[model samples]
Target chain A: MAVAIAEARIGKWGERYYSGRVLQLLERGLIAFRSSTWMIVFSGFFEPVLYLLSFGYGIGKLLPTIDVGGETVKYAVFIAPALLATSAMNGAIYDSTMNVFFKLNHDRIYHGMLATSMGPLDVALGEISWALIRGLSYACAFMAVVAPLGLIPSMWGYLAIPAAVLIAFGFASIGMALTSYMKSFQQLEIINMFLLPMFLFSGSFYPLSVFPEWLQFTVNLFPLTHAINLVRGLCLGHINVALAGHAMYFVIMIICGLFFTTRRLNALFMK
Target chain B: MPESLIHARGLTKKFGDFVAVNGIDFDVHKGESFGLLGPNGAGKSTAMRMIGATSSRDAGVLTILGKDPDKHGPQIRAHLGVVPQQDNLDMQLSVSENLYIYGRYFGLPRAFVKGKIEELLTFAQLEEKRDAKVEALSGGMKRRLTIARALVSEPEILMLDEPTTGLDPQARHILWDRLFRLKEQGVTLLITTHFMDEAEQLCDRLIVMDKGSIMAEGSPASLIKDYSSKEVLEVRFGSDRNQELAEKLRTLCERIEELPDRILMYTEDGEALLGQIYASGMHPKTSLVRRSSLEDVFLRLTGRTLIE
Candidate 1:
């Protein structure tokens, strides 16, 4: 079974080199990730739940119900989408950036891989795919628990599985790109400097309108803000055409981030 | 002669203002152990990198498996295995896990790699440490694992860059034994090292490089025969008097090299040379006779020692 996945036949080498190679790379990663500690897989499922327990019921008891999707909803229902989005974001960011930096500079793991048939594109795509898997698992676990508590109101909330994947890919792509250029462990602080602000002000905690008009324009620029908007709209059953724009933000992130990431990875490895 | 697996004419590489590998020409034949023997700053590694299809040459024609590195790096590299100078084994991974990942990099099946890992662990003498994480092993163990990792793909040409640079004498002998086994299996080996004894032991034919250029190229015995004599007679007059004493002994042999502490007389007949020195009434603190080696050839060619 392991052999079959790793030995999937490939067609060509140049340009489309990543097509046949990504799965093997992903399989390699899953083996390493699984064999190591394994505490991560189970522990990762708890971050969102803790947030739900601590903030949802703790702060929810004090605040009155808020209107979402043209109907009054409990405070826990309003905050669940944000917790889910951030959890996915955190999972992907950790996998794509920190682990990547360790592999590239400290461990020199990818250097050994590059000596073989595998190219830089394979490394980038495979890492992002693994990150997406990690993000998706946490997203699913969070949803599974919250659904039992009657937090999910809309049948459309199931679409957040795919939505969480999109957010993970978008952030993981850019995170890997940023890490490709990092020279030292100190440079990793820059990723947090970029992520923490977006997490705090991306309308995950409050509505975008609550911020001033000028500040709302700035909040719209961050991808997580759009992610929160999409998941919130879906979970709250607020269906509209504007949701396409929010979804497009992540798509654009995927395209541009993957583009720059492949270029940077190729340059780093090739040079 | 066997067909050349790697061919180069005036190959060169530069990093900004510093030229790492100068325009040099050579051909690496199939199924023979070839070497680049040089000092620390020599271009052995840069040339090896181009041949491994990873680093592109700045100028001149270079081909690995008859394909240009610039255009077909991955394609050419697919058939080659490289053990870089430094050990870069994944620290967080088990020994077997390292082999598994490297095999998958070549797109090899997991079942095939799993089978190969057992044989490789035995070859590396690391079967006891197979399940241990890499960081927990000793340096020699890690170096062995690195070489074993490179072998997972069963490559056509195995390139080892200074394979035993930091290893102790015992570790180095074990590595050389493993490499000899690979050679017996008819795998083409390309090795680079600054150790004269290592070059003498492993290399069938080698190029002596200095300051990014080839100083001489031949079999180890041929290089010594060509550049040095059958035996060297060493005589130490005290360090303060060696300079004055060297002039008196200059005409006594085919050649003479005076160092800070002693004078070396190169001659086919060391006993004759030593008798002549004693007949002239020059007293030495200590002296010995030894066969000439690649280090003498390097000294003859570059006027500097191979290793400080």
Candidate 2:
């Protein structure tokens, strides 16, 4: 009955591509999540925590403090927010890319959903929203670990959770969009190839100034660079107009990713 | 006459340069069981997809429940329950959850879907397997669960593509009985099948399709009557001699088909034809007499067997 009302409301436009039942897909994902192996889900949450313990704390003893935007901070504090951003990206990308690829190619889940009144846009939105849940939970989990350790020094650090979500939203959107075009499991390896270098060189560990000017410019183009910068600024209380610019990059990514994901899904299943 | 639940005129689809459905026309009325009977790659599944509102027609007119599919795909799809050729049940979910999620996909209320799940489980005869994962079920059970999932929306039209294609004989009979129950309940059924026996058992009306075009359209009995004799006489002297006897056998019946393994003599009376063949001093290794069927109709129309 709710569907009928929603359909009547949006009946004029986008009815061919959307049915306003995206939450139903979320419901399905949640149910499936209950039965799925919890080890993999926990592995995504634990990945950054391990990185923090090893790199942030272990390496922090050797190099005590770093200067960011003229504000001096411990090395552990500087990298904690970046780890949070990385955790969010990893969680969202894993769910959106690998899990979604399996469902799309092997399980044929979207074929079943689209055969109903639900459309391609509903699937794209529903799936991306589910991935965001994983991203959000990981952000919260990372914050829970770092907050007690004095890694977040500023009251403004609370905003990092939302920032992590935004970062997750960007990666999840683009991940699904890219995964839609993948035809085989081997092609999915290309994602990890790009992600590894982005994680290492996106100024997550050290300052981007350490690289050559051309290399720094290339690193800045990575979405992770903006994500790390945005979250780090909030954690260190380095408030500036530049923060909104980073957020806007993700907003544009969200829009473009959604547009292409919906189009690709429609072409693949509804053609 | 009842209004058509589905209408198609010159309906066509193309994948690259290959035409899948080419300028076919048909109408399915409310509460009728309509079949698209054809061999593989005969365009039956393509036409089914267009009417189900999942695939767009490249050039033609298609309307389901009085709305254009290209413009109102979701609205039209809301009235349809589609069972695809493959069993696409979510392996992560159990049987009941599969049905419940499908209902939710149609935007049905949660409480309503929960209630509907029990009824559908009972309808599909999977009540004992409700909590079992889809992967654990047998092929027939999986197919039944898929059908149950399709009915979760209580759709006016149920579109099944090759519903019993891979099932054993007993499983096919069970599926046929379930479909018959749906027909009795007045649900409009649209089925696509390469199995002539399945079409004969289920469809009230059907279109014979071949090479992306409709060869003929009618009820099973009418098609057999129009295109075949009343009965068929099957006689096999041996593989080597079957072809040799084609010319002599051709003179004994209204029509004859010389298959590699056997000779088919079409006549109004198979028993009388056999006696005549025997009187002509022709002794066959084996002989059988049977009533004409959709197989004979298909052979007569296309010069090929339905199963190929």
In the range B1-308, model 1's lDDT, one tens digit per residue, is 78998899999989899988899999988999999999998999989888876676899999877877786666677778899987778777799998888887777777898899999999899999988999899878888999999888888799999999888999999999999999999999999999999999999999999999999999999999999999998889888999988878987775999777778889998888888888989778898999999988998999888877
lDDT (10s digit) by residue, model 2, range A60-79: 99999998899888999989
Q: What TM-score does model 2 score on chain A?
A: 0.96
TM-score of chain A in every predicted structure:
0.92, 0.96
**Which pairs of residues collide in model 1?**
none
Model 2 chain A lDDT-worst window of ten: A2-11
lDDT (10s digit) by residue, model 1, range A1-271: 2223322433344432352567877777777777783677677788788878998888788875776556898989988998888888888899888889998888888788778776678888888999998888888889999988988888889988789999899899988888888888998998899888998899765677788889999988888888898888888778898788989988988888888888887666665
Model 2 residue A188 lDDT score: 97
* Model 2 local distance difference test score: 0.90
TM-score of chain B of 2: 0.99
